[model samples]
Target: MDKVLEGLKYAAAGAGGLFAYLFGAWDALIIALVIFVVADYITGIAKAATQGKLSSAVGFKGLLKKVMIFVLVMVGTVVDKAIPAANHAIRSAVIMFYIANEGLSILENAGELGLPLPKTLKSALEKMKDEKPEDVPAEEQE
Candidate 1:
């Protein structure tokens, strides 16, 4: 039992290290993205269930898309590493873009579920959703 417990601890640390390496630091932006991703997924299911349109295939596809968001983040990290001057700019942009995107989706799901949303919040998210990271000037990004 002692040996097994020690092995488990090593495995957990290895997994965590890999995750951090792949996703960069586990900062507030990452935390927000995680929360928004999970909330959006849950709200999506609720919205679909309420509309009687819930399907396993669609749900699986949604899961795939969510996974892809992280995959893109990994790609961004790779790019940042390649361009040392970037200083995690690419990864940060990817995370921020997805955070905005997922937040908007969550709001939409809430609306579908007959939940009232603040107009200002919705408009702000919409604006963020429309702004592509590449379109932002490099100076503004810094």
Candidate 2:
């Protein structure tokens, strides 16, 4: 009985360790961001379909851009590991950048569905979008 209990505990701990190794906080965040991005894209497409605004080409381009975001995150992970000292700074920034983008996109999705959004957040999003590319820091601008 004691041996069995120890074995079960070890197995559970090993599984948790695996999950933590594969899905660190930043990785988990990016996964959530990707889910939001996909949901937003689907809702936007559905809205377009209902409103006669469908465009396969534009949707494909948007998907490509989303793919680029993942590529950037992967690159950030590599940089993070390469540095081996900064304590996930690159990954954290990458996750934050994508989180902000996905959050804004989800807000747009909600708006398309006629859901109300906070005025301040909406205005801030507009301001962020309106800022010149050269003006915003590259990391934050993403």
Q: Identify the leading candidate in terms of lDDT.
A: 1
Clashes in candidate 1: how many? 0
lDDT of each: 0.87, 0.70
Each candidate's TM vs. the true structure?
0.86, 0.64
lDDT of 1: 0.87
How many pairs collide in each candidate, listed in order? Answer: 0, 0
Worst 10 residues of 1 by lDDT: 133-142
The residue-by-residue lDDT of candidate 2 on 109-129, one tens digit each, is: 678778898889866655544
TM-score: which candidate is best? 1
- Residue 88 in model 1: shift from native, Å? 0.9
lDDT tens per residue, model 1, 14-110:
9999988899888998999999999999998999899899999999988998998999999999899899999999999888888888888888889
